[model samples]
Target: VVGYELSNGQRVSKDEGIQMAKIGEIAGVAVATRKGNEYLRSLPDENENNNLGNLPSITD
Candidate 1:
């Protein structure tokens, strides 16, 4: 694992960086899902939550 300094001036382990990157990715997907759900809920449809089934998965 390669270590490096982040923009925050903190040294982070490569493993930690990988973990942080994964967390950020998951957060982004969650936000997208939330927004899509909100928009779908506002519409008069019975298929609102169905779109959530297509959310991206976090995996190696």
Candidate 2:
């Protein structure tokens, strides 16, 4: 994205990685279904990484 911006290519890389992550989540779902039984860590959930519990978003 930065490179495109520099060259004025009109293509954006900004947040493209974020988009790829979503696509990756879909891939993970597919793989988990065909390979074997889904496990806790293999599943996606809101509470999956909430080990610290609800906390502040920005402390600074």
Candidate 3:
């Protein structure tokens, strides 16, 4: 997972998205750490189809 395509059709780097999420500029996501690396994770919800991993992939 390199980056994300925002709902507004804008693409941001992973670091930028992390910062946004930290300041509450983004919603429905929480900052998480795995294996000493930080990343964004979707808040648990009833919608399985909306999971971040289930989203369509994009290319640079």
Candidate 4:
């Protein structure tokens, strides 16, 4: 994940940046899926069983 520092000296994940990248990578697949492309839709889920890393603290 991408990150950035805030003015108060705190770090935050750059969700928008990651989302944009994901969208770009999936754009073609999304279009093909919408156009009833069976091959694209048949692709396996790369992160289907992936975990979200360690859990975050409440204060985080």
Candidate 5:
């Protein structure tokens, strides 16, 4: 995903969200690295219905 739309309607870039997550500004997600690229992953839980992949895309 290119970015995320916060609940307050603010759109933040992937890197920005990653930075926020690092400082505990965002919750329920953990920072991960793959092939030298940093990314975000939802914390493991029993809820299968709210995975990040399941969220609707913001086309704007």
Candidate 6:
């Protein structure tokens, strides 16, 4: 999920994962950059879930 955001410092969220899945279904990497940016806008809060500390939020 954070693949693109790693170096760019964008971000990734659960919703983006969903969008990525849908976009990927129709085609691969098409408009993916935009989707990734959108995902970055709503990036997930690491502590939104169990608060395990540094744990990732499951999107799929």
Residue lDDT tens for model 2, 1-60: 121121223333424423443467222222222265321112345554532123223221
In order, candidate lDDTs are 0.39, 0.30, 0.90, 0.35, 0.85, 0.40
Off by over 4 Å in 2: 1-14, 25-60
lDDT tens digits, residues 1-60, model 1? 254344455666645654664566212222223534311112224655534334332322
Better of 3 and 6 by lDDT: 3
Residues forming the 10-long window of minimal summed lDDT in candidate 2: 1-10
Cα error, residue 22 of model 2, in Å, equals 0.3
lDDT of candidate 5 over 1-60, digit per residue (tens) = 889876678899999999999999877788999999998888878986666776678997
TM-score of each: 0.37, 0.20, 0.92, 0.24, 0.87, 0.24
Q: Higher-lDDT candidate among 5 and 6? A: 5
Candidate 5 clashing pairs, residues 3+ apart or interchain: none
Clashes of 2: 0
Clashing pairs in 6: none
When 3 and 4 are scored with lDDT, the better candidate is: 3
Residue 2, candidate 6: C-alpha displacement in angstroms: 12
Regions more than 4 Å wrong, model 5: none
lDDT string, candidate 6, 1-60, tens digits: 543322234455546644665555322223325734643232344545432223454433
Task: Please identify model 3 stretches exceeding 4 Å from their true place.
Answer: none
What order do candidates take by lDDT, descending?
A: 3, 5, 6, 1, 4, 2
lDDT of 4 by residue, 1-60 (tens): 344333355554555323433466322222123354222221244654322232232234
Lowest lDDT sum, 10 consecutive residues, model 3, at 47-56
| lDDT, residue 48, candidate 4 | 40
Model 2: colliding residue pairs: none
The CA lDDT at 55 in model 2 is 23
Measured on C-alpha atoms, candidate 4 has an lDDT of: 0.35
